[model samples]
Each structure stands twice: as structure tokens, then as C-alpha cells.
Target: MDHHEGLRETYAGEWQGLTNSEIRARYPEEYEAWSRGEPVRRGGGELATEVADRAVPVVLDAVDKLPDNGTVVVVSHGGTIRTMIGRLLDMEPAQWERFGGLSNCCWSVMGQGARGWRLLEHNAGTLPQPVIGDET
Candidate 1:
């Protein structure tokens, strides 16, 4: 298993370890901007793009080391994984929020296709069902 520190979640500066209510009470404006997907430095921490920049490379590097049919399992925090997916999909920072956050212990899957990378699943915990139109 490859572990990269760059895959760590966005640092929530002063908001670290605080509940949503606590952060909402303390940093209302910043929290609102965050909710709207506008870039705000949480507690003077990293931006979503910054997190993506650091994380995506690590993921790509791991992918490069895999055989064509091999699978790699990356254990990462939700925000970091989301950011990485946005980057991998060539999405603008604002569009990152379109991909909903993952529930605890849930995971996403991506596969390289003929066109490019595609998100096979999001926030999933079970084997994927066959697509309705697929024949195998």
C-alpha cells in the first residue's frame, strides 16, 4: 500500500475538531462561503485546488505503477478524495461540489476508459450492479 501525506484532508485551521454548529457560530461567513463552494481558506488552511494539486500527482504516480488490469486501493479522506476526483476529471474548482461528499467508510471508483477517466461509482460500499444495457 502506498501512503502519501499529500492525500491528507484539507486542513481546517481554527475549525479543526469543531462541530458544524461550533464553526457556524464562530465563522459564519466563511462557513457560508464554504457551503456555496466558493473558495475560502478554512482557518487559513489550504484551498480545494491546493489540495487537488498536491494529491492528484500522488494518485497518478500510483496509477502509473499499476499493470493495465491491476487495481489500486487508495484510502483517503473524503474532501481530499473529492478534490482529487475533480482534478482527475478536469473540473473547475466550483464544480467540485457537484460531486457530493462521501459517507464515512464509503468509497468511489474510477476507471480509465477509451475516452478518458470515468467515475464508475461514488460513495459506494457494495459491488456494482451490471448496467441495464450491457451484455456479458
Candidate 2:
């Protein structure tokens, strides 16, 4: 298991430790943009791209060290994981919100592919069952 401080969640700035209702009540505009998946300065906190910029290099460095078909388990905060996955798949930062947040202790699986990195699973908690008889 590897740990990096860059894998921490996007800093919530003054909103840290506040409940969603409290944040919504206090910063309605920022909360609205956040709920709508629009990129807004998150209370002068780090942007998604900024999170990716710091975290992606660490992830890529780890990936580079892996042997062929090797696996690495990365444990990270929900937003940071999403940003890293989006960046790995070459998705624009604006589309990072398309990926949903992960539940506590849930995880995502990614694999390198010919085209680039591919996400085999996202926000998953259970082991995947193999397809049977073409049943999807």
C-alpha cells in the first residue's frame, strides 16, 4: 500500500467539517454550482485539475514501476480518485463530475489499455462476477 499526501481530497477551505445543509445554507452559490457539476472556485480551494495535477504524477509513477499485468491498490479520497481516473482516461476536467462519488470504503479498478487507461469498475464495493453465456 502506498500513501501520498497529494491523494487527499480537494481542500474544502472554510467549508471543512460542515454538513451539506450547513454548506448549502452558508454558501448557496458555490453549493449550487457544485451540485450542478459546474466548476467553480470551491471557496478558494483547490480545483479538480489542480488535484489531478498533483495526484496523477504519483499514480503514473507507481504505474510505471509495475511489471506487466501487475496490480496496485490505491486508496484515496473520493474526489481525488475521481480526478485521477478522469485524467487517466483523458477526459476533460469539466467532465470529471460525470463520475459519481464513491461510498466509504468502496473502490475503483483501472487497467492500462492499448488506447490508454481504462476503468474496469468505479465506485464498486463487491467483487465482480464473471459473465455467463453472454449475459451482461
Best lDDT goes to which candidate? 1
Per-residue error for 29 in candidate 1, Å, reads 1.4
56-123: candidate 2 lDDT, tens digit per residue: 99988888899876877888899899999999999988898889999998999887656678787888
Separately for all candidates shown, the number of backbone clashes (residues 3 or more apart, or on different chains) is 0, 0
Residue 82 miss distance in model 2 (angstroms)? 0.6
Give per-residue CA lDDT, model 1, range 6-109, as digits (tens): 99989989999999899999999999999888999987889999999999989888899998688878899999999988888888999998998999989999
Alpha carbon lDDT of residue 120, candidate 1? Answer: 82
Residue 44, candidate 1: Cα error in Å is: 0.7
Candidate 2 versus the native: TM-score?
0.88
Model 1 segments more than 4 A misplaced:
130-136
**Candidate 2 weakest lDDT stretch, 10 residues:** 127-136
Per-candidate TM-scores read 0.91, 0.88
lDDT at position 102, candidate 2: 96
